[model samples]
Target chain A: MTPPPSATRPGAAALGLAGLLGLLLTVEVLPRSGVVSADYLPPTSRIVRALAVELNDRAFWRALGDTLTGWALGLAIAVVAGVVAGVLIGSVPFLRAATASTIEFLRPIPSVALIPLAVLLFGTGLGSTLLLVVYAAFWQVLVQVLYGIQDVDPVTRDTARSYNLGTWARVRHVLWPTALPYVMTGVRLAASVALILAITAELVIGSPGLGSRIAVAQTSQAVPEMYALIMIAGLLGLLINLAARTVERRALFWHQSVRGEAVL
Target chain B: MLDVRGLRKIYGGHGREVEALRDLTFTLDPGELVCLVGPSGCGKTTLLKCVAGLLAPTSGEVLLDGSPVTGPRPGMAVVFQEYSRSLFPWMRVRDNVELPLRQKKSLGRQRRHALVEDALEAVGLTASAGAYPWQLSGGMQQRVAIARALAYEPEVLLMDEPFAAVDAQTRAGLEDLVRKLWQERGMTILFVTHDIDEAVYLGQRVLTLSASPTVVQDELKITLPHERDQLESRADARFAELRTHVYAQIRAAGTRPAPTA
Candidate 1:
């Protein structure tokens, strides 16, 4: 049954904002009151001022754009590659078994560990960042897609087969719908991982992004500016996560989990 | 006509193999409505899957109109027991019903729409056609599954305990709906159930199956009037006799020890 619109309140949002303001006030007070070294940990007000200055800089915008470009491109490639590979491998028993060991072996190797190889192969450019981002993000999507495909009910498969649906038809009509929710979950996870790896690659490889900019500020002892850039990176992560969640909720409205949220 | 000749299905390999079906043999004449009744674990599902061409028999074959059924044929449709799983949750009721017709490619867009509407009307779900399967009641969802099968216009329909998940009242309603569909379409149907009364009420003939390593234990002609009512027909003396007869066979089959290799 659908509940009245007025019955649902924005209690969570109000509480979250209150908590964030309290945390920011504490951070601002700690260094200003000499509870911590202001040289290393500047007051929140100074960081905010540094953020305002950086926001107006043309170089800051270009670096932000480059980071996002790497994230988006790497995420796009991983999703397409993962879904195709996952569907193929998941549907075939022999292929699933053969690849299981290889997947498990490769999945655990940290993407950061491949930084040396990536730098050697692609130098300090978008390619280096993409290499790490794609490698990390690819696993998130591949595993989720595989799980999603496997989660398809056997009865549905049989029902499709009984109706004389061809391989392509079955995948389009049955398999895709059943696996979509899982794919969305995979994409959400991959989105976050892609951002993390993109920043890490830029930081380690001296690429032209916010991560490299933050590294430069730190080396020059621009503490407040470094904190501002770090805060921006954190904010970007939050924005990406929120956007992924919104997409998932909209796409999987028919799913029980999403429907349950609406009812609650 | 559909012929199942000595069908046997074994699961797993070598020492751990499970014999699901053993030497199962039967035939359905065109327009015949046959119900297979058995004890739990009697391999009714395995047999139905083999006949639907969804699974291969370890030995023997299923022949549909004199041709061996190697895979799913265009002339056959199946309504699986789990309606929730059988019907695509992502699609609307009408879309689910239209899917098989679209896949057939014989029906154009207009014909497909007419068939979907007709099937939904037959299942008394015309008003709910636009709703998703999850939005409907369990009985309604099951009806959508049936509607999907009906829209296919298959010569042979295989139903594996299709009404088992519904309540008694809903199950009775569906059983009547099925009988009405059968009489109207004159399509051959192979209905499987562990419920004795269901087999006796809905089928022209009832086939009883043995437990584990299942084989057809007995086949009995229902002999009930074609224009049977749920209240009157179920209360009939013949209905009581057939139900008792099938129940005794199932109980006997259940009590017997499974055969050793």
Candidate 2:
């Protein structure tokens, strides 16, 4: 929900930034000095120039849009489905008991294990990427939502019931507050997972995204352009993480875990 | 106004049956302030839960205004021991108090606001009405819970060791607050506690319960003046005598072996 306290410490960000710059310098020196062949690993300067060139290309922007569309759509579907399923299953004791074994059994299978099935069903398109992305992210949310519902205190539940609050009211006020922090936790994890699955689907299935562009560059022996596309993917993941954390902190400002982060 | 007739609660089944209450019978007339005193584990909580309609009895029933209570209804309200758990930390004190009233649909927005303000004023928490429960001290949090219950305006109020978690100083203040509220509101109150002095100090009649499988062992009537100062009432000879009697009953109950049903 929050960045580590070490990151918040005075001058820690500056020191981290310096460390990143140092790594960049080392890479620049290693490749230019031929310690690693330039063809295999381009120097930092060449990668940056290529990144600037790619930014000017309309094809690069389109690929970025396609990748983001897959991640966002998959994450949205997963969140809504997971929360509905989690709450419905959790609140009903009989339902929870009946489904417990099935959930446990299905949760651990890797999403990529279904890559063959995804390609067979939807071919090399956004649909193929979406299948993998949604599958990878749905369990992250469902498991956390279950944990949140279980964490609701018995006394609090009794308080709501004692007040004669109707079932819907109880869910809105009591259950929602207790489960929200966990749902945010689930979303954050899912966001990252969704991105990974999206790129993996595109690379393996030859879908139109940054991942496919990188593959094209690799096959064509355009080392600098390939590195540039990989950098763009890293930047996209970083931006998504930042957005997720911000949403979590804002939605859960009342929670203890997020309240402490506010002071920092 | 409140009647608990032949209440019995049995937990578990087969190999691990626990008969917490053999039978508990009591009545609180309108505006009656009765204290239920028992040993630490004498199923006081179980009894209170059943009376509040939060738990079903193994046998017998709780009646409010002569109607059977199958579950929590608008005519009844309860204050729990764990105030921190009872109050929603996500809501401010005012919202916490207003929540129950909001369910009443009959109350307009202005009326609901006024009731919330009045409850907060009664509990002397008007200034902290804007603060979250977690931001307040332990005693203040309990006051918020009391306000929430008060705002609901139940005809019969059930308090389950409501002051048990507070310190002695805070407990005395809360006891006086409760006394004032009962006198002002005229609601039938059944307060369950283990403290002998508190039982004697607060109740018109104190009922002492025996160990599990529990039953009412003794009843003592307190003859204190209507208007009482905590220090003066506590020092009175009659208060001492009544508390001693309840104390002895509790001690005996603690040592007595469970009888075979």
Clashes of each: 0, 0
- lDDT at B95, model 2: 91
Residues B76-145 of candidate 1 have per-residue lDDT tens digits of 9899899988888788889889887877666789989999999999999999988888888888899999
lDDT (Cα, 0-100) at A32 in candidate 1: 88
| Best model number under DockQ | 2
Could you tell me every candidate's TM-score relative to the true structure?
0.92, 0.94
DockQ of predictions, in order shown: 0.54, 0.57
Candidate 2 lDDT (Cα, whole model)?
0.91
* lDDT for residue A70 in candidate 1, whole number 0-100: 96
Candidate 2 vs. true structure, TM-score: 0.94
- lDDT to native, each model: 0.90, 0.91
lDDT of 1 by residue, A173-205 (tens): 888888899899899999999999999998889
